[model samples]
Target: MWRESSNIGRNQTSSYYVDNTLKHSFSNKTTAKQKSNDLKMPQPDEPYYCSQQIQIPPALPDILKQFTKAAIRTQPKDVLGWSAAYFRALANGETPPVKERLEMPVATQKTDTGLTPGLLRILNKQLGPRKTVDLNIIEEKWKDLALPKEQFDELVRIGGFGGTIEWLRYFALGCSALGENITDAMKTVCEILTADPDGGPSRIPFPLFKDLYTYLAKVDGEISQEHINEVTSHLQYYVDKQEGYVQPRNFTSPDCPKLS
Candidate 1:
């Protein structure tokens, strides 16, 4: 009887130990899984794809940095008149009147100012005799002139109504005509923008131009006058502000850089 009691007691103890061991194993596995899951989870504040704080540097020049000061220092009315004249010519599809050509000082003349008689002749020959010209031609000719940067600076000062957006667009056009080396200029602008985070007066123009060019380039054939008007109307808002200011809406595309 005592032996029977001992056997029964031993069996009970063995059964309890087995059950406790299984419970412990399951609890340990569940704890490990939960810890692994916690490690894999992302923090609430972290960005899933790219950080919002990561900014694309401004792709522009030092001249743009002092744009307000440069603008304030110079006579805006003269600049506005120049942009208006070009805008009006573009709007009317008329030949821009040849203003009395002034010889740029030798230092400035080395750059293609788009105001030169040779450039004017090229403009008339290609675009037909119109008072307002398509600004894209400036891009087409930048490389052939041998001094694109200087010429681009002149175009920025004179064309598109004085916006960073317009100047960048015009610059992009020039870069496209010149080919990939143009990207170096674009990177320069990006560097400038990155350095100066403030929406400084120096405008970024390529982003908008690429957008316009892509839409314009995709047309099956010649761009119709209607198309010209639509583009001009959109561009005018910025141009009217300064013969060169480019609109922000023009740069709202990720594919703009590839448009060239």
Candidate 2:
């Protein structure tokens, strides 16, 4: 009698456990279904807004037109990235990164880096007026050009630039990095800085050339200041005849003393 009662109790306990488990599982399913229904999209019967309620900004069309024209002229490599830069500049009321005109894609391919003369000219137009520029600002501008971060870092490292850097000095260093040698670098600099028409002899003031040449030579640590002074002194006579203008021809002439 005792054994039979014990077996009956066990069966009852097992049945209760099964029932409780099924009830808990069903409760969870019910709660999950309710939550999912809460998140489900409305059916066709429900409409959030009618088409007549939609509105557009009045200036959007003109803004988009200008943006399209800029994109067409700039010919940016990364449209999405450049677009972000363009919008950010507009929002902040700052100058946007853009090329003045379209250039052959191969203009920068000479150095196999993206630092083309036209791009540099654009950068100059924006940043040249400032004597010293913030490094963070330069990095932002560099990204807008879709230039390699590594190359930017390299220039910064080579210049040993800090929070604020001299713009002309940085510009000179950029020319150095862009060219094969010091002469080539100076030539590029003159071309970029000249007031003469495009494809004409790119001449910069001799005094300005003197300053840049002296600065770059001192930075190089290869040539002595005395040697640099001597070369500039020799060029001064030629510059005198030309009303203080120095061109690549002044340095590359047959009679000109070669720089070591």
Candidate 3:
């Protein structure tokens, strides 16, 4: 009987030990799994794919921001007019008239103070009766004239002289005092008007001529009624006789007489 009791006791002890061992193994496995899950957690510095946070883009440069604002505020309504003024400023080796300080000069008669007949004569002699005057010629003549830079700039600004058309008109108006024998003047103006931007013969749209006339009339009282009449008549002739545009040939041909 004693021997049987000892065997039973041994079995119970063995069973208890196995159960304790299993429990310890299971606890260790659970702790390892928990540690692995903790390591997988995202750090504060790392952005998670599932995160709802949004990053803002960097701001524009101060200069760029200012330029954008200025552009928005000062956008021109008349693109052609603006272009003319801009180009004229560039041709004169001055800053473009788009700046706020360079407002369009007042179109009063007092503004015509410096445009003397002598100056006009000088320009006429330089341009001559050429069918197409080079832009470089006009620019060089402008410098040779040695007119006050400030005054000339003011005239250009007020006249809204944007391109070759305005430059020609400015000289023509100044020369109007010489009477109607403006053959060379008419030819030069026509050349500039009809010449292509890339070089070669092109047509001058009537609307541009009209715009130029209107602007010139407002700026200079010395521009005679005959000048206005002649310009209108020529434009009408082109519309009726030629196509809606005036080509270089039209100006060079005998049909279009000198601006008398």
Candidate 4:
């Protein structure tokens, strides 16, 4: 009887140990599964957060944005130097220096005109020995060219005696627009104006040359008769000699014809 009771107790202890082990394992598996399901997934709109914090600012102002875009487009070589100069100018309450405006290259073939450097030298000599002349005189002479008033003023402000040469160039361009061959006309006009009293190349009187040029443009139908009338009306004294001929008293001398 004692041997049988001992065997039964041993069997019960073994069964208890096996049941405890299985229960513990099941509990652990259940806990792990619960943890996996409880964990939350992130929404699409939310930004991912790692260890670091990032700060984003609002949009920039329109003017500042435009300037930044322009700078990016230009792509200057020395960005830091440009920034320094820009800041310095701003601190000094002055405008920063900007790059010059680039003009598109014209591909038209250039025809040789008598307005060469040699002719320019002669014209300059005729204007007198002075390096500069009254800007008003040039402005008055070419007023009929009909360039923008502001642009003409700016040119006069910047260009000294050199402005006269620029005016002639501009006049040639204007005449070209009217279907007139300005180079040939300029050659003829210069020859006529420089013709001398004693049969030598002489200094042309500026006022007389201006009057003759105005007449020539009108006669060639480059400018309207109404335009000529308007110009003559502005003069203090003018005489109409015949059709397509006019004389300004100040330009007429004893030697030069009254009608130019």
Better of 3 and 4 by TM-score: 3
* Per-prediction tally of clashes: 36, 0, 2, 0
Instruction: Tell me the tens digit of each residue's lDDT in model 1 across 173-201.
Output: 33333223333333333323322344544
lDDT of 4 by residue, 179-214 (tens): 235334433344334534534434344454455456
lDDT of 2 by residue, 1-260 (tens): 99999999999999999999999999999999999999998778856887789787899999999999889888888999999989898898877877777877544234677887777877787688887999898887888889888888988888899899988888888888777678877888898999999888899999899889888887888988788877898899989898889999888787776654
Clashes of 2: 0
TM-score of each: 0.20, 0.72, 0.29, 0.21
Q: Which pairs, if any, clash in model 4?
A: none
* Candidate 2 vs candidate 4, TM-score winner: 2
Stretch of 10 with least lDDT, candidate 4: 97-106
Give lDDT per model, in order: 0.44, 0.84, 0.53, 0.44
Q: Which runs of model 4 end up more than 4 angstroms from their true locations?
A: 40-260
Highest lDDT: give the candidate number: 2
